[model samples]
Target: MALLETLAVVFAVALVAAVAVYIKTKLFPLGDGEEIREDVAEYISMMVSVFYALVLGLCLVSVWDNRATADDRVQAEASALHQTYLLADALPAEQRGPVREAARSYAGHVVDVEWPLMAEREPLGDDGWTLLDRLRTAGELRGPGTTAQQIAAQEVLAQIGYVDDARRGREAAAEERLSVVLWAGLVIGGVLTVAFMFLFGLNRSSTHVILVMGLSGFIAFTVLLIHQLDTPFGDPLGVGPDPFTRYFRL
Candidate 1:
């Protein structure tokens, strides 16, 4: 589901549950001296809250790190491609143009073709690999080239290798996500935390309702944030093709 829709559903459900509980409490008021031990329930609730907070923190940190790493990979790949394009200037005239052209084509393909696929969590076809191979072939140094040309060829190969590594890292990061068990824990934990709030009898129903609404909304927001970060290439929050665009002027 879309992020906004998911959030609306979560908050709506939470509101409905809170209201239903409030109504039940009103119809079946607790008799005098029948209240549970407030101190013990408070302590238990506090502990649960702390545990759930820690889980949420861990999830946030993990996804943020993944997103950062994905961005770094993109920058590194673009930089390597840029360097390869520049280094081609030192190649023998016969070899130089093809190398530069191949590098440019590869970068353009990444920005135009592969990026959209990544956002959709789709596999990149062999087109990119073909372009990279063309780049590598263009940089191949045959026997008896000028010393400067040889050095440029070697540097181009090195840069291409860097691009390969960074592309792999980018693809891996794109596929990375929080485990299903962790998601289950997050959902269940949030529900329990909100349910625990109902255990405490508030003096005013209005105050109780307000508190539940606020807490539920906050929890829903946090979950939505995590979901956005879960897919590093997802819309709006996902990393863009800015690196390639900046380096290639495309």
Candidate 2:
């Protein structure tokens, strides 16, 4: 099943369970009013809440780290592209325009074509790298440069290498999948926490308790929504690299 579908099923089951238990408890109050009075139940519920909070925090951090890493990689790649463009000045006059044109074309392809697809978690096609190879090869050093200049050129090219590798890593990071066990833990924990709330008569009045439940449910739903969108390259809330689009000058 799709991730969304699986999530839907989890929530459906949890909601049914919560409502069913709530109704049953209301309709037929335990004679002794002691369904969860035991110390063991209290301890277990507290431990579950703590574990859920930790897991939620960890998942949020992991997703945020992935996004931050991707953003940094893109920035580095752009910087390298810019440096490579500037390096065209070092090439012999006959090679300058072609190198510049190739760099521009590569950047344009990345911005116009690759960025959107990446935002949607799509793999970049082989063509981008093909263009990169052509561009890199376009500027051949015919004769030895002054040692310093040669070193500088090599440094710039090294930066280009970094950009290429980093971009690939960013793309791979976007495709990273959230662990299914974590999702299971979130769903189960949420249900148990909410159910525990119902078990205890926290709200003196039914209306207040129902209000709390609805509000809590909404919060849980929002967290789950973020989890769904954390892939940003995924369907719901993926971040696009359109920020670099204007450089295309196309």
Candidate 3:
């Protein structure tokens, strides 16, 4: 959703909540002790606060899980590519150099070229896929030599397949984000929860201000935290190319 639209929705929610509470207070003044339905208000406020907290927790968990999955994809891709590099040693002498170079080129492309693209949520193009295909071709060119060589070649192909799968997953994760509905829930829930605090009549104005300040600040912090973590390969809580660097020593 657009920023202005989101802000408008939040404002409307808070305004409605404030108007409702004001009417309730006016109809059943706590000071007059006219059978005040404070119990109902209290129940409602507690429920809003709890559900706001629950929504915050759910968003946090969702982002954290997405980040973890992205990290796993990176690790799996790097590990499989590393294994492919190692398996190059088992190929026949003529095939060894080509296979090793292909593996190195692919790893370098990932670390130097593709990592930045993923971080920026940009398309990586077919360069990566082409590189992977080259690695497969290099392994295939072994031309059915010895038994051990054949087995190693098979293993190399398997590792390349693993790398391909992980790369696809990584790409998918880069474009992933928190749902707009969840974002709306977060904002509306937070506003309502804070707004409900106004329903209660505190003896001390300072106490009310302090309580509102703390609650609003906490809600803002959590929402911002979730926003930062929403992108699988973006800032503060993003998955990095450290796995590739670690595996390939890039």
Candidate 4:
């Protein structure tokens, strides 16, 4: 839906600019084929195009890095939970069952409940945090009977800590997004870039129209790409629940 809206806006702008340019040429026309006007237009167009390209490149890099970080967080969280699940074997028999169960339950909640919410950019609610708390409590085994048990308990605590930290990071990443200011810049910059295309004088009407259409389409596509990447949990290009599924078999 968002992509469609962006495309519509870009197309509308391009069509309006093209029509306006065509009408201007028919009515007013160029003055005595002035070389100065063409020179000035060419210089301004070149400068604007360069600046716009830089802005687009920066936006792309920012969003790409964010998406990559989000993926890494998901992997880290899933791996930590998997480690905690395995460490349960070293825990006292009484503690092992509950700890392992809690770990499994947490992974299930993340894959089934939290993932959908993240994709929608919605809050995950207290349920996920509650599950994490349960996992933490289950691992709080005080003073084991033997040195080996004590060592195992410490390892369990460490793994659980890692899980807690990674879950927090994952939640943060899910909520991450481009700022409104950056969005404004993207839209305004795209408009200016397309509008500048009209300033340059072209002898062939067909060539001018084609250039406008191609430029508009490319801008719209780039904006759509940034939007999709802005929300790492968004569909198609989004990070999936594969890490959790692989570890928990959910």
Candidate 5:
């Protein structure tokens, strides 16, 4: 089974067990002297919390790297498109404006339409790329006249290739859903963190109140962090849309 499915099963079992134990303890009292060891519970909760923090730290680091990579790719793509647009001047005058216009239009599409879609983890279709191809074809690319013109054409072609590669990279990055294993770890870790709370029955009613509040807060915080990292675009903590906006004056 997939790791997620496995974790789901485990989590369900653990949750049921926890509820049963809680109910059973309330329904029937243990022997007068028999109860959980306080020191042992403290040690276990401390260890589990430390482990949870470590896992959370690692997850944050991974997500940060992914976010940085995506941002860098966007900047690189915008710069390449700008270079290609400027290079349009090398083309015959009749061809220059159209080529530059196409590049500009494509950039606008990226900023206005495609960028937002990407933020939402959506990919724009062939239409966007087709416009790029139109720009590429706009130039009357000739054979080896002066070595310079040939070199310029080669450079333009390279820029075109970069844009294509960058787009593919962006798409791949978007598709990079967090692995099922990591998700499994997250779920199991959460359950374990909470289970560790019940390792010892609460002595004072005040202690029970505090434990319940603390566990609820921790769970809420962890879940919010994960959600923000998961989207990497839509949430306040997500990667920004500066990539597209910076390119165009838009």
Candidate 6:
């Protein structure tokens, strides 16, 4: 639904701009004496488009890499937590329940609480780390009595270490954002690219409308794509709780 609405809006804007440009050409046809060289105009338009494409490609790559990093961190964190959960069964009977409960609580907190904060780009409190500390404490409360229990406890601690490292990465990724200068360039370059095409339009009226509208629509779509990718944690683009649900059944 969101995609449909966005496409409709972009197409509408492109249609309107094409109509306006077409009307302008009819109202003020270029005089023979005022006409610029067609080759020069085409060269200028091509350069503007190339420069704009460079900026667009940079922005797209920046956001896409950030999004991929965020997803990777999520996968690592969930995997480590799942390892922690599995190691609990090897723990002493009394310690097993607390450790499992701690793992479940940690998973729930991430999915139910921390995820929303990330989606909103909100500052995360230390509560998540605190839960991690609790999990560590829960697992380490009693010393392992047997050699097997010792190995299990040590492995569990190592997995928790992985979870902590991945959590840090996730936090960093959540704060990732595209630079303001790039965004300014994106907007200005798009406007200039479209404006140049409008200025040096085609001779055929129908062809002019088609060409201009197609360029306009494609540019609009690119801008929208950049914006969507910029918000790696937000809806319509973000990876959800699938990793957690897969392992912990959250």
Best candidate according to lDDT: 1
Deviation of model 5 at 70, angstroms: 0.6
Tell how far residue 115 is off in model 4, in angstroms: 1.1
How well does candidate 2 score on lDDT at residue 58? 72
Stronger candidate by lDDT (5 vs 6): 6
**TM-score for candidate 3, residues paired by index:** 0.84
Residue-level lDDT of model 5, residues 1-250, one tens digit each, is 6985877787798899899989988998688899865786688689877887787777767776776677677777888888888887775556568868888888887777876776688867787888888877864475545566667777788898898787777666655666667667676687778877666676797998798779868876876677577665555776565755666666
Worst 10 residues of 5 by lDDT: 139-148
Q: What is the TM-score (0 to 1) of candidate 6?
A: 0.83
Score candidate 5 by TM-score against the native.
Answer: 0.75
Each model's lDDT comes to 0.89, 0.72, 0.86, 0.85, 0.73, 0.87
All candidates: CA RMSD (Å)? 7.1, 6.2, 3.9, 6.5, 5.1, 8.6
**Superposed model 6: Cα runs more than 4 Å off:** 1-38
Show the lowest summed lDDT stretch of 10 residues, model 1.
1-10
**Candidate 4 structure lDDT:** 0.85
Q: Which segments of model 3 are wrong by more than 4 Å?
A: 1-34
TM-score of each: 0.84, 0.74, 0.84, 0.83, 0.75, 0.83
Question: Candidate 6 on 1-250: residue-level lDDT in tens?
Answer: 5545655666797799889979988998889789655897789789978988999999999999989998999999999999999999888999998898999999999999989999999998998999999999977737538988888888999999999999998888889888876776787678888788677656798998898799889989988988888878788998687898889987
Candidate 1 residue 64 Cα shift, in angstroms, is 0.6
For model 4, residues 1-250, the per-residue Cα lDDT tens digits are 5555665776798799899989988998768865445676778778878878888898899888988988988888889889889888887889889998999999999888988899999998999889888988888776546778788778877877787787788888888888655676688788889998887768999999999999999999999999999889879898999998998888
Error of 2 at 151 (Å): 4.5
Candidate 4 collision pairs: none
| Deviation of model 1 at 165, angstroms | 0.5
Error of 6 at 166 (Å): 1.0
- Which is the better candidate, 1 or 3, if ranked by lDDT? 1
Output the worst ten-in-a-row residue range by lDDT, candidate 3. Answer: 28-37
Cα lDDT tens digits for candidate 3, 167-231: 99988888888877788889888878988888887999999999999989988999999988887
Q: Give the per-residue lDDT of model 2 (tens digit) for 1-250.
A: 5657767787898799899989988998888756655776688779978988887777777777777777777777777777777887876676678878887888888877877777666878798889888777765555786665576567556766876887787677778766675676677767777777655554358776776679578758757775765775555556555444544455
The alpha-carbon deviation from the true structure for residue 180 of candidate 1, after best TM-score superposition, in angstroms, is 0.9
